[model samples]
Target: MKGNVNSPLHSDYLNNKMKSVQRRHSELKHATPHKLRHTRATLAKQAGTSIEAISEALTHSDTITTKTYVNASNVIPMAVGEIAYRNLKK
Candidate 1:
C-alpha cells in the first residue's frame, strides 16, 4: 500500500478502509474526512498563518469562506495589535 500513488484510492475504497481502521480504533468513533480537513485548517490558523494565505492554500473560492477558520488567538490580530501599540508609544 505504501508508495503506491499510481493506484489512487477511490471514494468507496477510502470509506471501506476507514470503516476497518475505525473498528480497530474504537476511540476514533464518529471521525470523518471533513473533520480532518477542519482540523488541518484550525491548526494552520493557530500556527500564525494569515487567513488569506490559508484560503489560498485551501483553494477556497471566497475569502469569507476562509474567514470561518479565523480565530481571535491567531497571529494576524496579535501582530496588528503589537504594531498599533508600538506606534502609540512612539
Candidate 2:
C-alpha cells in the first residue's frame, strides 16, 4: 500500500518487512531503520560533512540532538586519527 510521510508504516511493520527481506535473501541480520540513520550520520561526519548540515538533513529540532547521534563510537577517533596523520605529514 502507498503511504505518505505522515502515514508512514508503523515501526513493527517496518521491522517485519525488513525481516522478510532478510529471510528472502538468506541474510542473518538487517540493520534497523534507527541503526541505519545512525550509520548515515556517522558516515556523513567522517566524510567531512558539517554537523549543521547533518542535523538539518536528519531534521533534528536541536543541534544537541544531532550531536548525540554523532557519537564517539562512530566519528571522533577516526577524525582525530586523520588529523594526527595529516600533522605527521607536515
Candidate 3:
C-alpha cells in the first residue's frame, strides 16, 4: 500500500496474483508430460482401447506409433505380452 500501482514493488504483486488463485494446478512443476502420455496410452491398451483410437488421441500419424507406446514397457508387443498372458490362463 506504500508504493504506487506502477512501482516495482506493485509489479511483483501483480506478477504473483494469478499464482495464488490456484493451489492444485502447481502439481505439474515436477510432472513429465511425455511419460504421462505413454503411460495413458499403455493403460488404455491394457483396458482394450482400440489402437486406432489411441493413435488419434496421441496425435500420431500412424497407429504403429501408438502401438509402440503401448508396448514400450514390453518387448515384441502382443507376440510377447498376449502370448504370455494366454499361456498363463491355460
Best by lDDT: 2
Per residue, candidate 2 scores C-alpha lDDT tens digits across 50-82 of 889999988898778888887646565457667
* Candidate rank order under lDDT: 2, 1, 3
Note the Cα lDDT for every prediction shown: 0.69, 0.78, 0.66
Candidate 3 lDDT for residue 16: 64
lDDT of 2: 0.78
Of the candidates shown, which would achieve the greatest TM-score relative to the real structure? 2
Best of the two (1, 3) by TM-score: 1
lDDT by residue (tens digit), candidate 3, 9-85: 45456446545643557754433445667878987676556789989878899997777788655533455567567
TM-score of each: 0.58, 0.60, 0.45
Record all residue pairs in model 1 with backbone atoms less than 3 Å apart, i.e. clashing.
none
Per-residue lDDT of model 1, residues 1-90, tens digit only:
778855655778777877888999988767666566566677667655677888887779887987775544543434656656756897
Candidate 3, poorest ten consecutive residues by summed lDDT:
6-15
Regions of model 3 farther than 4 Å from truth: 1-31, 72-90
Q: Cα deviation in Å at residue 90, candidate 2?
A: 28
